[model samples]
Target: MSVTQQRFMRRGVTKFLFLKAIADAGNVPLRPELASANATDLSGAISDVAGWSLANSPIDTPDMGSPMTTNIPGEDKADSSSLTFYEDLAAETIETLLTKGVVGFVVIMRKGDVPASKSMDIFPVRVAGRAPAYSAGSDPAKFTVTFAISGEPTLDAAIPASS
Candidate 1:
């Protein structure tokens, strides 16, 4: 009997790349090449993340001909997502790069830093807000930056070899 093994996203292995770029005439940012020079790996700075998913609202279609109500998937919207990063003001850090109104693509590699042969999710996002999370305890200084997904994310796209 053969047993299948399951893989999980382990801490310190998952990578988040934030590419600061503008969209072209097509209203979509150009997909960056794998391991692009312009991409900034924000994994080390990021402490936590939330809500980077697309959700669909069902359209209720009830008819008099049937007792049961029929529903269809209407549209898919990228839910609000946020990344909490340890605030660092030393030179080019998360605080300086991720400011309000900055637009870019957020590539998430759940399988880790190994770019080749892995799948990644690309999200076109705008930095919506930035709020500092001050604490009186011994926790490190952190801030949360909210992202507004401008368009539908490209899910499960294969990561290519770096050029």
Candidate 2:
């Protein structure tokens, strides 16, 4: 087997691995299946690194369709799809906390050596959190986490980069 493939299998699935895989793929647009596969690998890796099961904790799967929310009309429809996705997955991450009476948090990805998008390709993951790692005021560990509630997100970027 290829060395790269061998390396990938060693890591468990998680958002961190998901992003890295996407970045490494370069000009290649990452399909949902590929992303899901990596997330699986990354999760295991993270469990090993953190010595905890954060990667598979609530165990979620990457989206299996286009990042675009069905190309349907109305901004609300698009927004709902995007929000539901994050809510479901994010919930898993924070599910244990919820039953113990916890709600809402600022889940940050905290930038490192990670770079911004160059291909203009929107990552299919429901929520993305990134920042400039070397910037003075920037926290290298500060990353953004997408949030959702009541079947919709408070913020939706489905319209591309029109913000």
Best by TM-score: 1
Q: Write the per-residue lDDT of candidate 1 for residues 39-105, one digit (tens) a residue.
A: 7888888888999999999999999999999999999988789999887767647777888999888
State TM-scores per candidate.
0.84, 0.19
Candidate 2: RMSD over Cα atoms? 18.4
**Pairs of residues clashing in candidate 1:** none
lDDT by residue (tens digit), candidate 2, 118-145: 2122233332221112337642222223
lDDT of 1: 0.78
For candidate 1, the 10 contiguous residues with the lowest summed lDDT are 22-31
Off by over 4 Å in 2: 1-13, 16-72, 75-96, 105-163
